[model samples]
Target: MCRMARPRKPLLSRDRIVEAASALVDSEGLDAVSTRRLAAELGVSGPSLYNHFRNKDEILDAVADAVSAQIDLSMFDESDPRDWRAALHDWAVSYRAALTEHPHIVPVLARGPGRRPAGLRVADAVFGAMVGAGWPPAQATYIGALMRYFITGSALGSFARGFVDDETAYDPADYPHLGQAHLLAERRRQVDEGAFETGLRALVDGLSVQYELLAPGGTVRPAPKRS
Candidate 1:
């Protein structure tokens, strides 16, 4: 009897696992991802997933890192006379864009870089760019943290989605100022994008003022001493 020939390509892989898990989260929220479900989606046994990932959390972490890898850090270049403000504005926009595409993973990504390599690279690029642009080490760290908070918060949920689409949901007797609130859901994309842009501009503007204060000969106020 002739022996059977082995298939050319492997059935399971780390990339395929992450891709499936990410897609599951994107389509059915984070809670929808599981070892068994992922295995079924990949057409493999649950034990096979273990070969690529130790556990579900590890798989989630990989998925989050994959999303992080999608972020654009090219704006934070190592060029002289770097325009840190411009770089930050562009970086924040790019960051929001990636998170918007995968809102389900925002919580995991918001947990700081942890041991995720792609997440760490993002932090490194942001901090390095700030320092190279004349921001002190401590301030650079603060800027990185602040931007993360702002971007993650923006991606967590949509303000427009909180409102009911029914015209009578916002009763004028109770909410006189929200007469047009019912329309928010219909214009969600516009409202959310506009809100993000508005907040991004305000944040960058505020940071620009703070950056100028660190200028040579500018008044740099000392931090309050702890009791």
Candidate 2:
């Protein structure tokens, strides 16, 4: 008697390909990930990977989205506009912490923007928060861009520390304020962590003043006469 072989499971799936690519990026830097490499990692042929993803860029987009999924958006709540500043600072801090875990993927995020859903979702959330707080479109976009630059810049600096040494050896006479700030930062027990929050809040508060000035009929005050 002839017996039918057991049904075979599907040989490939988009989810499986993306997950494997994500793993590669998490372990190795973005430069280390490739379609051929992913296929080999997945025990499949290079062409088989194309059946799911068009090319390396497509795979990268998928991987970025996958990384974004790991983020918890509850860090920002629509219920409170007053804490929008704290919410945003917390969100950025959490994102920095999260990226630190996957140092390899940080570069990909630092470069690519439009291709991934997660990145867009974050932009949307920031804009939405600003709008909910009654900020104009331009102001919201400006704040979002500023925050992006600060967080990504810090991330890249930390990531590149091995190469840069990240030391600030300045004479007190030459940079007294800088020296004072450095000493104060060094004295704090949670300096590294608290530093980001402190700077973020100060940045947001400064921008809020600008937002008010840019509003209709609001007086554009010149720099408060510097003493």
Identify the candidate with maximal lDDT: 1
List per-prediction Cα lDDT, in the order shown.
Answer: 0.90, 0.71
Off by over 4 Å in 1: 1-4, 79-82, 215-219, 222-227
Q: After superposition, how far is residue 55 of candidate 1 from its true place, in Å?
A: 0.6
lDDT of 1 by residue, 1-227 (tens): 99989966566889999999999999998899999999888888999888888999999999999989998988886753448888898999899999999999999999988999999999999998988778888889989999999999999999999999999888899999999999999999999999999999999999887876675744466655899
Per-residue error for 17 in candidate 1, Å, reads 0.7
| Candidate 1, pairs of clashing residues | none
Give the per-residue lDDT digits (tens) of candidate 2, residues 1-227: 99978747556898988888888887776887888798788787899887877889888877776776666567566665546666777788777777656667666777746857788888888888876666777778888888877876665543222222223655567867654454443444355456666777888788766766654544355656778
Candidate with best TM-score? 1
